[model samples]
Target: MKQRIAWITDSTAVVPDELREKYDIHVVPLDVIFEDGAYADGIQLSSSELYEKIDHSKTVPKTSQPAIGKFVELYEQLAEDYDCAIAIHLSSQLSGTYNTSKSAAAMSEFPVEFVDSQIVSYPITTLLLKGISLAEQGMDYREIAATLREEASKNENYIVIGKLSQLHKGGRLSNAQLIVGTLLQIKPIFCIRNGVVELFEKVRTEGKAFRRIMDQLDLARGIHKISQVEILHGNVMDKALELKETIKSKYQDIEVLVYPLSPVLGVHGGQGTIALTWTNEPKSS
Candidate 1:
Protein backbone atom coordinates (compact mmCIF):
# COMPACT_ATOMS: atom_id res chain seq x y z
CA MET A 1 0.00 0.00 0.00
CA LYS A 2 1.14 3.56 -0.74
CA GLN A 3 1.78 5.97 2.11
CA ARG A 4 -0.51 8.98 2.40
CA ILE A 5 1.27 12.30 3.04
CA ALA A 6 -0.12 15.66 4.08
CA TRP A 7 1.60 18.92 3.02
CA ILE A 8 1.72 21.68 5.63
CA THR A 9 3.20 25.17 5.71
CA ASP A 10 2.90 28.42 7.62
CA SER A 11 1.17 31.63 6.54
CA THR A 12 4.49 33.11 5.49
CA ALA A 13 4.66 30.70 2.57
CA VAL A 14 2.99 32.19 -0.53
CA VAL A 15 1.24 29.23 -2.10
CA PRO A 16 -1.52 30.32 -4.44
CA ASP A 17 -5.05 29.49 -3.37
CA GLU A 18 -5.71 27.28 -6.40
CA LEU A 19 -2.49 25.37 -5.94
CA ARG A 20 -3.14 24.93 -2.23
CA GLU A 21 -6.59 23.59 -2.97
CA LYS A 22 -5.36 21.22 -5.65
CA TYR A 23 -2.51 19.86 -3.54
CA ASP A 24 -4.42 19.94 -0.25
CA ILE A 25 -1.62 21.95 1.32
CA HIS A 26 -2.50 23.15 4.84
CA VAL A 27 -1.36 26.51 6.20
CA VAL A 28 -1.10 27.62 9.82
CA PRO A 29 -1.12 31.35 10.44
CA LEU A 30 1.08 33.48 12.72
CA ASP A 31 -0.28 36.34 14.81
CA VAL A 32 0.33 40.07 14.30
CA ILE A 33 -0.18 42.06 17.52
CA PHE A 34 -1.25 45.68 17.36
CA GLU A 35 -1.74 48.05 20.26
CA ASP A 36 -5.32 46.89 20.70
CA GLY A 37 -5.16 43.16 19.92
CA ALA A 38 -3.62 40.37 17.89
CA TYR A 39 -4.90 39.28 14.50
CA ALA A 40 -3.97 36.11 12.68
CA ASP A 41 -1.87 36.79 9.61
CA GLY A 42 -3.87 36.26 6.41
CA ILE A 43 -6.89 35.28 8.51
CA GLN A 44 -8.41 38.27 10.27
CA LEU A 45 -5.95 40.76 8.76
CA SER A 46 -4.73 40.94 5.17
CA SER A 47 -1.52 42.54 3.94
CA SER A 48 -3.40 45.64 2.83
CA GLU A 49 -5.28 45.85 6.09
CA LEU A 50 -2.07 45.44 8.05
CA TYR A 51 -0.47 48.29 6.09
CA GLU A 52 -3.53 50.44 6.57
CA LYS A 53 -3.47 49.89 10.30
CA ILE A 54 0.20 50.72 10.43
CA ASP A 55 -0.35 53.93 8.53
CA HIS A 56 -3.00 55.07 11.00
CA SER A 57 -1.30 53.93 14.18
CA LYS A 58 1.66 55.48 15.94
CA THR A 59 3.33 52.16 16.75
CA VAL A 60 4.53 49.30 14.60
CA PRO A 61 2.99 45.86 15.12
CA LYS A 62 4.87 42.76 16.27
CA THR A 63 4.48 39.16 15.13
CA SER A 64 4.24 35.94 17.12
CA GLN A 65 4.38 32.29 16.17
CA PRO A 66 1.31 30.12 16.25
CA ALA A 67 0.45 28.41 19.50
CA ILE A 68 1.63 24.81 19.99
CA GLY A 69 -1.91 23.75 20.74
CA LYS A 70 -3.02 24.93 17.32
CA PHE A 71 -0.58 22.61 15.60
CA VAL A 72 -1.55 19.77 17.92
CA GLU A 73 -5.19 20.18 16.93
CA LEU A 74 -4.24 20.19 13.24
CA TYR A 75 -2.14 17.06 13.70
CA GLU A 76 -4.94 15.34 15.55
CA GLN A 77 -7.30 15.96 12.68
CA LEU A 78 -4.76 14.80 10.08
CA ALA A 79 -3.90 11.67 12.06
CA GLU A 80 -7.30 10.26 11.17
CA ASP A 81 -6.62 10.21 7.43
CA TYR A 82 -2.94 10.67 6.68
CA ASP A 83 -0.06 8.33 7.35
CA CYS A 84 2.39 11.18 7.95
CA ALA A 85 2.87 14.91 7.36
CA ILE A 86 5.59 17.26 6.11
CA ALA A 87 5.47 20.75 7.64
CA ILE A 88 7.65 23.35 5.91
CA HIS A 89 8.17 26.69 7.60
CA LEU A 90 10.31 29.85 7.41
CA SER A 91 13.88 29.86 8.66
CA SER A 92 14.44 28.92 12.29
CA GLN A 93 16.86 31.84 12.54
CA LEU A 94 14.16 34.26 11.41
CA SER A 95 11.23 32.97 13.45
CA GLY A 96 10.40 30.48 16.22
CA THR A 97 7.59 28.91 14.21
CA TYR A 98 9.67 25.91 13.12
CA ASN A 99 10.67 25.09 16.68
CA THR A 100 7.12 25.52 17.89
CA SER A 101 5.91 23.22 15.15
CA LYS A 102 8.48 20.62 16.16
CA SER A 103 7.25 20.65 19.76
CA ALA A 104 3.66 20.32 18.66
CA ALA A 105 4.51 17.49 16.30
CA ALA A 106 6.18 15.62 19.14
CA MET A 107 3.05 15.82 21.29
CA SER A 108 0.69 14.69 18.55
CA GLU A 109 -0.35 11.07 18.03
CA PHE A 110 0.61 11.33 14.34
CA PRO A 111 4.02 11.33 12.75
CA VAL A 112 5.25 14.68 11.41
CA GLU A 113 8.36 15.56 9.45
CA PHE A 114 9.56 19.16 9.44
CA VAL A 115 11.49 21.21 6.88
CA ASP A 116 13.10 24.38 8.19
CA SER A 117 13.20 26.13 4.84
CA GLN A 118 15.95 28.42 6.11
CA ILE A 119 14.22 31.10 4.07
CA VAL A 120 10.90 32.90 3.80
CA SER A 121 8.25 34.36 1.41
CA TYR A 122 7.93 33.04 -2.14
CA PRO A 123 10.97 30.81 -1.74
CA ILE A 124 9.03 28.79 0.82
CA THR A 125 6.26 28.57 -1.74
CA THR A 126 8.70 27.26 -4.32
CA LEU A 127 10.01 24.60 -1.93
CA LEU A 128 6.54 23.35 -1.00
CA LEU A 129 5.46 23.24 -4.65
CA LYS A 130 8.61 21.34 -5.58
CA GLY A 131 7.99 18.81 -2.78
CA ILE A 132 4.49 18.20 -4.06
CA SER A 133 5.91 17.49 -7.50
CA LEU A 134 8.45 15.07 -6.03
CA ALA A 135 5.70 13.21 -4.18
CA GLU A 136 3.65 13.00 -7.35
CA GLN A 137 6.64 11.31 -9.00
CA GLY A 138 6.37 8.42 -6.49
CA MET A 139 8.92 9.59 -3.97
CA ASP A 140 8.10 8.60 -0.39
CA TYR A 141 7.36 11.10 2.35
CA ARG A 142 10.86 10.90 3.79
CA GLU A 143 12.50 11.36 0.41
CA ILE A 144 10.31 14.35 -0.35
CA ALA A 145 11.14 15.92 3.01
CA ALA A 146 14.85 15.39 2.50
CA THR A 147 14.71 16.75 -1.03
CA LEU A 148 12.95 19.90 0.16
CA ARG A 149 15.57 20.47 2.85
CA GLU A 150 18.33 20.27 0.27
CA GLU A 151 16.47 22.49 -2.21
CA ALA A 152 15.92 25.03 0.54
CA SER A 153 19.64 25.65 0.60
CA LYS A 154 19.73 26.62 -3.08
CA ASN A 155 17.26 29.49 -2.78
CA GLU A 156 18.76 32.95 -3.45
CA ASN A 157 16.95 35.82 -1.75
CA TYR A 158 17.51 39.59 -1.68
CA ILE A 159 15.46 42.36 -0.11
CA VAL A 160 15.57 46.15 -0.39
CA ILE A 161 14.48 47.72 2.87
CA GLY A 162 11.91 50.53 2.52
CA LYS A 163 11.80 51.87 6.05
CA LEU A 164 14.80 52.22 8.36
CA SER A 165 12.64 52.86 11.40
CA GLN A 166 11.09 49.38 11.28
CA LEU A 167 14.48 47.62 11.20
CA HIS A 168 15.68 49.77 14.11
CA LYS A 169 12.56 48.93 16.08
CA GLY A 170 13.01 45.22 15.27
CA GLY A 171 16.59 45.38 16.65
CA ARG A 172 18.18 44.40 13.36
CA LEU A 173 19.87 47.77 13.28
CA SER A 174 21.50 49.89 15.97
CA ASN A 175 20.66 53.51 16.77
CA ALA A 176 23.92 54.79 15.30
CA GLN A 177 23.58 52.80 12.08
CA LEU A 178 19.98 53.96 11.66
CA ILE A 179 20.90 57.59 12.05
CA VAL A 180 23.76 57.34 9.58
CA GLY A 181 21.79 55.30 7.06
CA THR A 182 18.89 57.71 7.26
CA LEU A 183 21.17 60.69 6.81
CA LEU A 184 22.93 59.13 3.86
CA GLN A 185 19.75 57.81 2.23
CA ILE A 186 21.33 54.38 2.31
CA LYS A 187 19.21 51.54 1.01
CA PRO A 188 20.59 48.22 2.14
CA ILE A 189 20.24 45.01 0.19
CA PHE A 190 19.76 42.04 2.49
CA CYS A 191 20.18 38.36 1.73
CA ILE A 192 19.47 35.15 3.61
CA ARG A 193 22.61 33.15 4.32
CA ASN A 194 22.71 30.05 6.53
CA GLY A 195 19.10 30.80 7.49
CA VAL A 196 19.83 34.28 8.83
CA VAL A 197 19.14 37.56 7.09
CA GLU A 198 22.38 39.40 6.49
CA LEU A 199 23.25 42.74 4.97
CA PHE A 200 24.50 42.06 1.46
CA GLU A 201 25.27 45.59 0.27
CA LYS A 202 24.48 49.21 1.01
CA VAL A 203 23.75 51.55 -1.87
CA ARG A 204 23.17 55.28 -1.70
CA THR A 205 19.73 55.11 -3.30
CA GLU A 206 16.92 52.65 -4.07
CA GLY A 207 17.71 52.81 -7.79
CA LYS A 208 21.29 51.81 -7.12
CA ALA A 209 20.12 48.97 -4.89
CA PHE A 210 17.93 47.68 -7.72
CA ARG A 211 20.84 47.80 -10.10
CA ARG A 212 22.85 45.71 -7.67
CA ILE A 213 20.01 43.17 -7.57
CA MET A 214 19.97 42.95 -11.35
CA ASP A 215 23.72 42.51 -11.38
CA GLN A 216 23.39 39.71 -8.83
CA LEU A 217 20.78 38.03 -11.02
CA ASP A 218 23.15 38.28 -13.97
CA LEU A 219 25.87 36.59 -11.96
CA ALA A 220 23.49 33.85 -10.80
CA ARG A 221 22.39 33.13 -14.35
CA GLY A 222 26.00 32.77 -15.39
CA ILE A 223 26.56 30.11 -12.70
CA HIS A 224 23.24 28.26 -12.69
CA LYS A 225 20.07 27.84 -14.68
CA ILE A 226 17.19 29.84 -13.18
CA SER A 227 13.71 29.01 -14.48
CA GLN A 228 11.48 31.26 -12.41
CA VAL A 229 11.85 34.41 -10.33
CA GLU A 230 9.46 35.84 -7.76
CA ILE A 231 9.21 39.51 -6.83
CA LEU A 232 7.47 40.09 -3.49
CA HIS A 233 6.51 43.47 -2.10
CA GLY A 234 4.88 45.00 0.93
CA ASN A 235 1.94 46.78 -0.71
CA VAL A 236 4.08 48.11 -3.53
CA MET A 237 2.60 46.61 -6.65
CA ASP A 238 3.79 49.31 -9.03
CA LYS A 239 7.43 48.96 -8.13
CA ALA A 240 7.15 45.17 -8.21
CA LEU A 241 5.59 45.33 -11.67
CA GLU A 242 8.28 47.65 -12.91
CA LEU A 243 10.94 45.26 -11.71
CA LYS A 244 9.03 42.37 -13.28
CA GLU A 245 9.08 44.13 -16.64
CA THR A 246 12.79 44.84 -16.41
CA ILE A 247 13.58 41.20 -15.60
CA LYS A 248 11.33 39.96 -18.38
CA SER A 249 13.06 42.23 -20.88
CA LYS A 250 16.43 40.84 -19.92
CA TYR A 251 15.50 37.17 -19.64
CA GLN A 252 12.66 36.36 -21.98
CA ASP A 253 12.72 32.62 -21.26
CA ILE A 254 12.49 32.89 -17.49
CA GLU A 255 9.08 33.18 -15.83
CA VAL A 256 8.44 35.95 -13.33
CA LEU A 257 5.79 36.18 -10.63
CA VAL A 258 4.76 38.99 -8.31
CA TYR A 259 3.07 38.52 -4.95
CA PRO A 260 2.27 40.50 -1.82
CA LEU A 261 4.36 39.83 1.23
CA SER A 262 2.39 38.36 4.12
CA PRO A 263 1.39 40.72 6.90
CA VAL A 264 3.73 38.88 9.25
CA LEU A 265 6.60 39.73 6.93
CA GLY A 266 5.33 43.25 6.21
CA VAL A 267 5.53 44.08 9.90
CA HIS A 268 9.28 43.63 9.69
CA GLY A 269 9.97 44.82 6.12
CA GLY A 270 7.57 47.75 6.26
CA GLN A 271 5.62 49.27 3.37
CA GLY A 272 7.35 49.72 -0.03
CA THR A 273 9.81 46.89 0.62
CA ILE A 274 10.70 44.62 -2.32
CA ALA A 275 12.07 41.09 -2.23
CA LEU A 276 13.58 39.19 -5.15
CA THR A 277 14.00 35.43 -4.89
CA TRP A 278 14.76 32.44 -7.10
CA THR A 279 16.01 28.88 -6.86
CA ASN A 280 18.62 27.37 -9.18
CA GLU A 281 17.29 24.50 -11.26
CA PRO A 282 17.22 21.29 -9.20
CA LYS A 283 19.96 18.82 -9.94
CA SER A 284 18.88 15.32 -10.91
CA SER A 285 18.83 13.02 -7.86
Candidate 2:
Protein backbone atom coordinates (compact mmCIF):
# COMPACT_ATOMS: atom_id res chain seq x y z
CA MET A 1 0.00 0.00 0.00
CA LYS A 2 1.12 3.59 -0.65
CA GLN A 3 2.01 5.84 2.29
CA ARG A 4 0.62 9.29 2.99
CA ILE A 5 3.07 11.93 4.31
CA ALA A 6 2.59 15.23 6.12
CA TRP A 7 5.02 18.11 6.75
CA ILE A 8 5.36 20.09 9.99
CA THR A 9 7.48 23.10 10.94
CA ASP A 10 7.74 25.71 13.65
CA SER A 11 7.00 29.42 13.27
CA THR A 12 10.65 30.43 12.85
CA ALA A 13 11.04 28.60 9.54
CA VAL A 14 10.02 31.76 7.56
CA VAL A 15 8.49 29.84 4.63
CA PRO A 16 6.70 31.73 1.84
CA ASP A 17 2.87 31.74 1.87
CA GLU A 18 2.35 30.17 -1.54
CA LEU A 19 4.75 27.35 -0.80
CA ARG A 20 3.14 26.71 2.55
CA GLU A 21 -0.27 26.45 0.86
CA LYS A 22 1.03 24.34 -2.00
CA TYR A 23 2.79 21.88 0.29
CA ASP A 24 0.17 21.94 3.04
CA ILE A 25 2.88 22.56 5.61
CA HIS A 26 1.76 22.90 9.20
CA VAL A 27 3.31 25.56 11.42
CA VAL A 28 3.46 25.21 15.19
CA PRO A 29 4.02 28.59 16.84
CA LEU A 30 6.35 29.62 19.66
CA ASP A 31 5.56 31.87 22.61
CA VAL A 32 6.98 35.38 23.13
CA ILE A 33 6.52 36.58 26.70
CA PHE A 34 6.87 40.15 27.89
CA GLU A 35 6.69 41.25 31.50
CA ASP A 36 3.11 42.40 31.06
CA GLY A 37 1.82 39.97 28.45
CA ALA A 38 2.37 36.79 26.41
CA TYR A 39 1.76 36.14 22.71
CA ALA A 40 1.98 33.29 20.23
CA ASP A 41 4.24 33.89 17.28
CA GLY A 42 2.43 34.48 13.96
CA ILE A 43 -0.80 33.87 15.78
CA GLN A 44 -1.45 36.63 18.31
CA LEU A 45 1.66 38.75 17.57
CA SER A 46 3.25 39.75 14.29
CA SER A 47 6.90 40.72 13.83
CA SER A 48 6.04 44.41 13.63
CA GLU A 49 3.75 44.27 16.65
CA LEU A 50 6.37 42.46 18.67
CA TYR A 51 9.04 44.94 17.66
CA GLU A 52 6.76 47.85 18.53
CA LYS A 53 6.21 46.39 21.96
CA ILE A 54 9.94 45.90 22.37
CA ASP A 55 10.69 49.48 21.38
CA HIS A 56 8.23 50.81 23.94
CA SER A 57 8.85 48.41 26.78
CA LYS A 58 11.39 48.96 29.48
CA THR A 59 12.45 45.30 29.34
CA VAL A 60 13.36 42.78 26.69
CA PRO A 61 11.03 39.90 25.87
CA LYS A 62 11.75 36.15 26.06
CA THR A 63 10.83 33.33 23.65
CA SER A 64 9.90 29.70 24.28
CA GLN A 65 9.33 26.78 21.97
CA PRO A 66 5.86 25.43 21.55
CA ALA A 67 4.75 23.31 24.49
CA ILE A 68 5.01 19.54 24.10
CA GLY A 69 1.26 19.32 24.49
CA LYS A 70 0.81 21.47 21.41
CA PHE A 71 3.04 19.19 19.42
CA VAL A 72 1.33 16.05 20.70
CA GLU A 73 -2.03 17.48 19.79
CA LEU A 74 -0.82 18.34 16.30
CA TYR A 75 0.81 14.97 15.66
CA GLU A 76 -2.25 13.09 16.93
CA GLN A 77 -4.44 15.05 14.55
CA LEU A 78 -2.10 14.64 11.57
CA ALA A 79 -1.69 10.90 12.26
CA GLU A 80 -5.43 10.57 11.88
CA ASP A 81 -5.20 11.57 8.23
CA TYR A 82 -1.63 10.91 7.15
CA ASP A 83 0.18 7.61 7.57
CA CYS A 84 3.29 9.39 8.89
CA ALA A 85 4.61 12.94 9.42
CA ILE A 86 7.94 14.65 8.93
CA ALA A 87 8.70 17.40 11.47
CA ILE A 88 11.42 19.93 10.68
CA HIS A 89 12.44 22.30 13.45
CA LEU A 90 15.07 24.95 14.28
CA SER A 91 18.58 24.18 15.45
CA SER A 92 18.73 22.36 18.74
CA GLN A 93 21.65 24.59 19.66
CA LEU A 94 19.47 27.66 19.21
CA SER A 95 16.20 26.42 20.73
CA GLY A 96 14.56 23.48 22.54
CA THR A 97 11.83 23.14 19.93
CA TYR A 98 13.48 20.13 18.38
CA ASN A 99 13.54 18.19 21.62
CA THR A 100 9.96 19.13 22.35
CA SER A 101 8.89 17.92 18.94
CA LYS A 102 10.88 14.72 19.28
CA SER A 103 9.19 13.86 22.53
CA ALA A 104 5.79 14.57 21.03
CA ALA A 105 6.63 12.42 18.04
CA ALA A 106 7.43 9.47 20.29
CA MET A 107 4.07 9.82 21.96
CA SER A 108 2.09 9.77 18.73
CA GLU A 109 0.76 6.50 17.27
CA PHE A 110 1.91 7.10 13.67
CA PRO A 111 5.53 6.97 12.57
CA VAL A 112 6.82 10.52 12.70
CA GLU A 113 10.25 11.53 11.45
CA PHE A 114 11.86 14.44 13.32
CA VAL A 115 14.66 16.50 11.78
CA ASP A 116 16.91 18.89 13.64
CA SER A 117 17.69 21.39 10.91
CA GLN A 118 20.89 22.63 12.62
CA ILE A 119 20.05 26.08 11.23
CA VAL A 120 17.37 28.68 11.77
CA SER A 121 15.32 31.32 9.91
CA TYR A 122 15.40 31.09 6.15
CA PRO A 123 17.97 28.33 6.11
CA ILE A 124 15.54 26.09 7.96
CA THR A 125 12.82 27.12 5.55
CA THR A 126 15.00 26.26 2.58
CA LEU A 127 15.78 22.86 4.06
CA LEU A 128 12.10 22.09 4.62
CA LEU A 129 11.16 23.18 1.11
CA LYS A 130 13.61 20.66 -0.27
CA GLY A 131 12.04 17.92 1.82
CA ILE A 132 8.55 19.00 0.79
CA SER A 133 9.56 18.87 -2.85
CA LEU A 134 10.84 15.34 -2.43
CA ALA A 135 7.61 14.27 -0.77
CA GLU A 136 5.56 15.81 -3.56
CA GLN A 137 7.54 13.68 -6.03
CA GLY A 138 6.29 10.55 -4.22
CA MET A 139 9.45 9.79 -2.28
CA ASP A 140 8.89 7.50 0.68
CA TYR A 141 9.55 8.59 4.28
CA ARG A 142 13.01 6.99 4.55
CA GLU A 143 14.20 8.31 1.21
CA ILE A 144 12.95 11.79 2.04
CA ALA A 145 14.67 11.72 5.42
CA ALA A 146 17.96 10.70 3.83
CA THR A 147 17.75 13.50 1.30
CA LEU A 148 17.02 16.11 4.00
CA ARG A 149 19.96 14.96 6.09
CA GLU A 150 22.32 15.18 3.12
CA GLU A 151 21.04 18.64 2.16
CA ALA A 152 21.20 19.93 5.76
CA SER A 153 24.91 19.13 5.94
CA LYS A 154 25.53 21.81 3.28
CA ASN A 155 23.85 24.74 5.09
CA GLU A 156 25.68 27.88 6.26
CA ASN A 157 24.10 30.73 8.22
CA TYR A 158 25.48 34.10 9.36
CA ILE A 159 23.98 36.95 11.39
CA VAL A 160 24.89 40.66 11.73
CA ILE A 161 23.90 41.83 15.17
CA GLY A 162 22.84 45.51 15.46
CA LYS A 163 22.76 45.59 19.26
CA LEU A 164 24.71 43.60 21.79
CA SER A 165 22.63 44.69 24.76
CA GLN A 166 19.53 42.80 23.64
CA LEU A 167 21.44 39.60 22.93
CA HIS A 168 23.28 39.88 26.22
CA LYS A 169 20.04 40.35 28.14
CA GLY A 170 18.54 37.47 26.19
CA GLY A 171 21.37 35.25 27.54
CA ARG A 172 22.99 34.37 24.20
CA LEU A 173 26.03 36.46 25.08
CA SER A 174 27.84 37.28 28.28
CA ASN A 175 27.25 40.65 29.93
CA ALA A 176 30.98 41.31 30.30
CA GLN A 177 31.51 40.69 26.61
CA LEU A 178 28.63 42.97 25.74
CA ILE A 179 30.02 45.74 27.92
CA VAL A 180 33.46 45.44 26.35
CA GLY A 181 32.02 45.43 22.81
CA THR A 182 29.76 48.38 23.64
CA LEU A 183 32.65 50.35 25.10
CA LEU A 184 34.46 49.91 21.82
CA GLN A 185 31.30 50.40 19.63
CA ILE A 186 31.79 47.05 17.94
CA LYS A 187 29.31 45.17 15.76
CA PRO A 188 29.50 41.38 16.15
CA ILE A 189 29.16 38.83 13.37
CA PHE A 190 28.08 35.28 14.23
CA CYS A 191 27.81 32.11 12.19
CA ILE A 192 26.28 28.72 12.70
CA ARG A 193 29.15 26.31 13.06
CA ASN A 194 28.42 22.64 13.78
CA GLY A 195 24.82 23.56 14.68
CA VAL A 196 25.80 26.18 17.29
CA VAL A 197 26.24 29.91 17.14
CA GLU A 198 29.89 30.90 17.21
CA LEU A 199 31.44 34.36 17.09
CA PHE A 200 33.01 34.80 13.66
CA GLU A 201 34.39 38.33 14.07
CA LYS A 202 33.64 41.80 15.29
CA VAL A 203 33.55 44.78 13.00
CA ARG A 204 33.57 48.47 13.89
CA THR A 205 30.25 49.06 12.05
CA GLU A 206 27.29 47.30 10.48
CA GLY A 207 28.47 48.18 6.95
CA LYS A 208 31.71 46.32 7.53
CA ALA A 209 29.74 43.37 8.86
CA PHE A 210 27.60 43.22 5.72
CA ARG A 211 30.75 43.38 3.62
CA ARG A 212 32.21 40.55 5.63
CA ILE A 213 29.03 38.47 5.08
CA MET A 214 29.16 39.07 1.33
CA ASP A 215 32.81 38.10 1.30
CA GLN A 216 31.99 34.82 3.02
CA LEU A 217 29.16 34.14 0.55
CA ASP A 218 31.50 34.74 -2.37
CA LEU A 219 34.01 32.36 -0.89
CA ALA A 220 31.39 29.64 -0.37
CA ARG A 221 29.98 30.04 -3.88
CA GLY A 222 33.49 29.63 -5.29
CA ILE A 223 33.79 26.33 -3.43
CA HIS A 224 30.27 24.88 -3.80
CA LYS A 225 27.23 25.05 -6.07
CA ILE A 226 24.73 27.24 -4.20
CA SER A 227 21.08 26.24 -4.62
CA GLN A 228 19.22 29.06 -2.81
CA VAL A 229 19.85 32.42 -1.09
CA GLU A 230 17.75 34.23 1.52
CA ILE A 231 18.38 37.56 3.22
CA LEU A 232 16.55 38.04 6.52
CA HIS A 233 16.20 41.20 8.61
CA GLY A 234 14.17 42.75 11.37
CA ASN A 235 12.37 46.00 10.51
CA VAL A 236 14.98 46.83 7.90
CA MET A 237 13.51 46.16 4.49
CA ASP A 238 15.48 48.86 2.67
CA LYS A 239 18.83 47.53 3.74
CA ALA A 240 17.66 43.97 3.10
CA LEU A 241 16.57 44.95 -0.40
CA GLU A 242 19.89 46.63 -1.11
CA LEU A 243 21.75 43.58 0.11
CA LYS A 244 19.47 41.33 -1.95
CA GLU A 245 20.24 43.41 -5.02
CA THR A 246 23.95 43.20 -4.30
CA ILE A 247 23.75 39.41 -4.11
CA LYS A 248 21.58 39.19 -7.23
CA SER A 249 24.02 41.36 -9.12
CA LYS A 250 26.86 39.08 -8.19
CA TYR A 251 25.02 35.79 -8.85
CA GLN A 252 22.96 36.74 -11.87
CA ASP A 253 21.67 33.19 -12.38
CA ILE A 254 20.21 32.82 -8.88
CA GLU A 255 17.33 34.84 -7.48
CA VAL A 256 17.81 36.28 -3.98
CA LEU A 257 14.73 36.53 -1.76
CA VAL A 258 14.32 38.82 1.24
CA TYR A 259 12.07 38.23 4.24
CA PRO A 260 11.60 39.49 7.76
CA LEU A 261 13.03 37.35 10.50
CA SER A 262 10.21 35.85 12.52
CA PRO A 263 9.45 37.47 15.86
CA VAL A 264 10.74 34.45 17.82
CA LEU A 265 14.13 34.72 16.11
CA GLY A 266 14.01 38.53 16.28
CA VAL A 267 13.75 38.35 20.06
CA HIS A 268 17.28 36.98 20.26
CA GLY A 269 18.73 38.65 17.12
CA GLY A 270 17.35 42.01 18.29
CA GLN A 271 15.45 44.61 16.25
CA GLY A 272 17.94 45.52 13.51
CA THR A 273 19.72 42.22 13.02
CA ILE A 274 20.19 40.83 9.51
CA ALA A 275 21.02 37.25 8.58
CA LEU A 276 22.24 35.62 5.35
CA THR A 277 21.66 31.90 4.78
CA TRP A 278 22.17 29.48 1.88
CA THR A 279 22.62 25.83 0.99
CA ASN A 280 24.67 23.96 -1.60
CA GLU A 281 22.73 22.31 -4.41
CA PRO A 282 22.76 18.56 -4.35
CA LYS A 283 25.12 16.98 -6.86
CA SER A 284 23.63 15.44 -10.00
CA SER A 285 24.18 11.84 -10.92
Cα lDDT, all candidates: 0.91, 0.84
Please write out the lDDT profile of model 1 over residues 34-114, one tens digit for every residue: 999999999999999998998787778889999999999999999999999999999999999999988988998688889
The candidate that achieves the highest TM-score relative to the unseen native structure? 1
How do the predictions measure up, each by TM-score?
0.95, 0.93
Please give the distance, in angstroms, between residue 11's alpha carbon in candidate 1 and its true position after superposition. Answer: 0.5
Local lDDT at 24 for model 1:
93
Q: By how many angstroms RMSD does model 1 differ from the true structure?
A: 1.8
Could you give me the TM-score of model 1 versus the true structure? 0.95
User: What is the lDDT for 74 in model 2?
Assistant: 92
**Model 2: per-residue lDDT, tens digit, 182-262?**
888788898887789898998987888899999999888887788578888988999899998888888897778889988
Q: Which candidate comes out best when scored by lDDT?
A: 1
